[model samples]
Target: MCWKTLLCCSLWLLLLKSNENLAFKIPSIDFEMLHELGFEVSIPDEPGMQRVFYMLQIDDNCPALMDYITESNNGSWISRQKTSLQNNDKLQISVLVQYNDEIYEKSETRVIINARLLTTRDGRSQSITYPNGEGECHAYLSPQKQAKRCKPAQSIVSSSRQTCQGELLFEDNFSEAQLNRSTWKHDIRQRMYHVEEELVAFDDAPRNSYVKEGYLHIVPIVASEVVEGSFKLGDRCTAVESPEQECNIAQGSFYSIKPPVFSAQIHTRDSFSFKYGKIVVRAKLPKGDWLFPYVMLQPVSTYAETHYAKQLRVAYARGNSHLQSNQQEDISGSHLYGGMVVWPHGRAMQYLKDRLSKAHYGDSFHNYTMIWQRDKITLMVDEEIYGELYEGLSFFNEKCFIIFGVTVGGFLNFDDSVLAKDVKPYLNREPRAALSFWQQRDTWAPTWGKHSSMIIDYVRVYAE
Candidate 1:
């Protein structure tokens, strides 16, 4: 009887010890210390990580587990190497969720690392709770004997681009002292029935498009300033297969004399086109009333009558410092806009607009960027991303070529309901749009000042 009683007591004590080890809460988890170390875990989302709160500092008796987790650099652990006072930062894994029940109920709120440091005779324990709470994971790394690895249903690679993933596909420093004609084709087409309804006609004149010092500048000149009366482009026009009407124009009635403005427009429609990648453009927006400066991507094979249709705008800004939306908020050179537009099967024009406001984008150069991926697209100005779109628009799924230009007096961007209508000369429906715009030049021209050029420093595209 005494022997049996002792056996029972020993088994009970062992069970108690086992429970204590399993109940171990996360250690070295002082948020104050984390702040002191300048180490951050997602109380909120960070770039590249959305709602993921993993960044844990823990001491491990198991060096094998620590090394595997830290070195893997994989999402299975969601970890990074960090430090503590004793420098006992063995493994980094974030466990405690902020515990928002409502958010957790809707989507995945947490991924637990159940590091069960249990005593095994072999010194390797099994634990590493996956997202779905399966029991297959073990503490030690096993090569052949492992969990099920699943492959995605669709291929992520794009068929149009043959470049290696993450490779630099295209880059231009604009330091050559001239536009690389092989890469950039000047667009000097006359605005007729099937072109942009802009008030300007692009031309290849040296003053309108040139490389000065090390920068590529696309400057806009008043047609009346370049020529006292009607201007003639003649054969210097770069647009191929242009019609005879493109040769000359004389100021006349409401069909609207020659284009009131002359600007430089350039694109890489033939030299380069890609399916999906990241694009970065360093540029300063032109500051001039009624002027439009844009960095965008155009469909290589398809064409849209509206310039903004079926295109992805990296950065677009109106030169007017006083323009406002129907809501009365300023929407001019002070604001940077980026978006993707699609005319969905003539159903309706569908677009997603993103805007960021500062004192003025023209005051200094800004980095405009677009990250185009298989599932998402992100637009950013400098360090701040102001726009994102998911797999909603099919227009973004195909290949596109890069385009940079400074255009003038397009009615779609400058809305009719703008509060600055007193200064705005032409509405979208005006029959003689160009005539009305030129007639009001007295009110808008002075605002152009000496800042009537769009300066580009560089453009780069990278494959994803």
Candidate 2:
């Protein structure tokens, strides 16, 4: 180091070490503005010549207290930890300032933490316990079901002294101007899902899906509107298997063309995927023949990402209104369905929990809930139990992410022979299924008015 710089640094340290004539100011605790578990330790602005450090130590009698140190941030220091301080405890904070390699203890300040809290070695409700009786206390917390004092309304874990059960894990209200891409990633591809072969292109275009007026609106549109001739998804498609086949389509014939309709599919696979939990969705079903809206799940594995593991449709609804089965039963948009795909004895099977309502699910908003356990799955609508499956979840041991989408004319979901009086437009085995659906859009497109949009008010997933 240069002689002049070294001499000035040494003099600065020596000046701060002196008790009677200090060069810089020491920090003080702002107990009056203290957080539940933090002391507002701050120091005044120091000159630009050299840096000053504030290191604080709690009294040894203070249980689980840890030391905190910080250089001034914009001329101040404020910090909080995930700990609690009991009420009416006299907290003695020893203030120290460090310059270069030297730390000098300036003075000690005594203040009451709060009126109702106290430090206790025993893990008591409303009592904070810190090991070693020093600096910060973040170790032990009570398991009570009540809220704690001085806790901010928004917190992840240990918001207060109380324990947590059925914590809300994830939620979205779609109140923003655009879809939360971080939370709900758009899967831009055509008929590439593990289950069901839909004659639809799931695009990332805002016309197919977007957030508006506090609701997530997923609308089914004609593919020709987005792409007139041969379609290619290019970089927007995330299909891992057969990217060329899954993400592109060439005009085959006048009647047989690219995926007949355009739609949207989004998922939480990138953001959130869990094994067992409770999921609730407030949504208005879509209206139109063969329009399928579902909140689905898939395991977070490459094999399951394609077609190898069991899946869960937390909730699903068909968009055909006034359709009936050949057995003289209602099989249309008025019913809600959810099922679990299980693999047992080298075979894959699916069991469903279905509910029928007097009104079309597309007519208004309804709460569709799914409670998933290790060995059971339950479905509900507006607090009423719909149905459940009592199968063990032993097939997949990995966490699964959430998926919500609106697809049109899938082979498996729409049974052509099931509809009585031949309401179905095309057979499941027909190669030109997409063209057939689009040709008859004059009859079905009228059904998909603005009210027919799949409107999701919110989706909430809670810990089980």
Clashes of each: 0, 16
Residue 62, model 1: lDDT of: 22
lDDT of each residue in 174-268, candidate 1, tens digit only: 88867899988887755532223677888778999888777889998886642246556666755444345564566554464767788878888
Give the Å shift of residue 276 in candidate 2: 1.3
CA lDDT scores, all candidates in order: 0.58, 0.62
TM-score of each: 0.63, 0.62
Q: Kindly list the per-residue Cα lDDT of model 2 for residues 1-464, writing each as its tens digit.
A: 22223224643445345455355445443443332223444455444323432222233342223233345667654433333333344444434455444444543444443222333322211212233434442211122122322322121221222222245667898989999988888877777232236777788888989888899988888654422677778887777777877777765544345676778878887777766667788888898777888677777774222633567887777888877788888888888888777666745577888988888898988888887766677788875777878864565566777777888776557766565645776656666556666677788878777765788999887555
Best by lDDT: 2
